[model samples]
Target: MANITAADVNKLRQVTGAGMMDCKKALVEAEGDFDKAIEILRKKGQKVAANRADRDSAEGAVIAAVNADKTSGVIISLNCETDFVAKNESFVKLATDLATLALNYETKDDFLAASFNGLTVADKLTEQTGVIGEKIEIGSYEKLDGPFVGAYIHAGNRIATLVSLSANVDGAEEAAKNVAMQAAAMAPLALNEEGVDSAVVEKEIEIAKDQLRQEGKPEAMLDNIAKGKLGRFFKDNTLVNQDYIKDSKLSVSEYVKSVDSNLTVTGFRRVALA
Candidate 1:
């Protein structure tokens, strides 16, 4: 048997982020061959991932990254099975690194295929599933690009948002981040009434009409009342129409306009841990 020294086990541990004993066992299984030991560890990860395929990875980190020019941004949620693993420093760092790398790819599939320290992002997540003993995966991925874009990550890494503006002007950073925070806190469904889906609008209108009928309103009046209620729904649920959380007197649209008359929130994306 080839001698599996302590240094060899430690090196494998560093390279694979596996438990010390697991690294030692893998090295012994590979007869102290580093490359073969790494392959064994990867196969172990693949096996663990397969075993945990049905598990729910509902808790983890929500992270966002924007390019230096602030014209584009991406937000991603790296999900795991438990809050205990989500709170680990190394786990948060991994999420942060993934978010940073995600800025280079426009789609989740592309990001998963991108290289990370010689491993694809998807492979890394599978590998981490074995190291952490939990199902690990990316739960959400959103990208935005415009004249200006900014990101905000809520405390504890539970929520993240990206906001895009109509123009990149002075104070755009502050404006964009403030709007992004509003998005994180309010969880707006869309940027404006025009952005709302037709199905959602129909559903809200029907719900409003049903509520009016429950209140004993006449059937003929239901259409007008429901239309008004739908307008209120848009104001409450749409990003630009919602009242600003910081200064409720002004709408989000008004607040952005205060920064610059030409400035407007063009788009936004939000993701939260489930």
Candidate 2:
């Protein structure tokens, strides 16, 4: 067996950002061969990654980036095991870098496969997990494109929203940003009643009817009452039909019309760390 020196272990730790004991063990297991020691550390990282694969990583930041023209944007959620690690500067920086990468990569798989410095993002994440002593992952990712795309990151970076508009007008970008904020706050399920899942609509209607029946409402009035209740649900849960949070007097659709009559929300994406 080759002798493993303290100097060799320290050097390996510096190069790999792995724990001291981990570096020492790798050096001992590699027979003090430097290159083999590095490989051992990488494999150790992979092992850690595999061990923590099932761990919940709900604490992290939602980040976003937009193009110069404000016509394209990307949003991403970087998840960690604890809030302390989530607030770490290094973790937040990694989230920002990933959000930037999401601008070019359309899917989470692509973002994970993206290159970071000298290694792929997945490998880098594995290395980070070993160093940070926790599980970490990309919880969600999305790219949006339209005539006007606005991105918003809510308090503590916990929620991210992207709003895409159908028209590019004088105030379209500003309106879209407000809509993004609305999404972050209201958690709308879809763009409008048309976008909501039909099954969900039916379920909501049935729930409404059941509640009315429990109240001893006449069966003859069930359909009309349930339809009214369904309308209320859509107005509360759909993006355009929702009352504008900033100006409750106007619906979101009305707010957009006030901004630019031709401008409308084409689509939106929202992601939260939880």
Our tally of clashes for model 1 stands at 0
User: Which ranges of candidate 1 are over 4 A from the true structure?
Assistant: none
lDDT tens per residue, model 2, 1-274 = 8888889889988788778998898888988998898777777778888999999998998898988888899888888899999988878988998788778777789778989867788888887887787888888878889988998999788998999998888888789889999999999999999999999999998999999999999999999999999999999999999999999999999999998877788899999876
TM-score of each: 0.97, 0.87
Clashes of 2: 0
Candidate 1 residues 1-274, lDDT tens each? 9998899899999998999999999999999899999888888889999999999999999999999999989999999999999999999999999999999998999999999988999999988988889999999999999999999999999999999999999999999999999999999999999999999999999999999999999999999999999999999999999999999999999999999998999999999886
Q: Give candidate 2's error at residue 191 in angstroms.
A: 0.9
lDDT of predicted model 2: 0.88
Please report, in order, the local distance difference test score of every candidate based on alpha carbons: 0.94, 0.88
- Superposed by TM-score, candidate 2 places the C-alpha of residue 164 at a distance from the truth, in angstroms, of 0.6
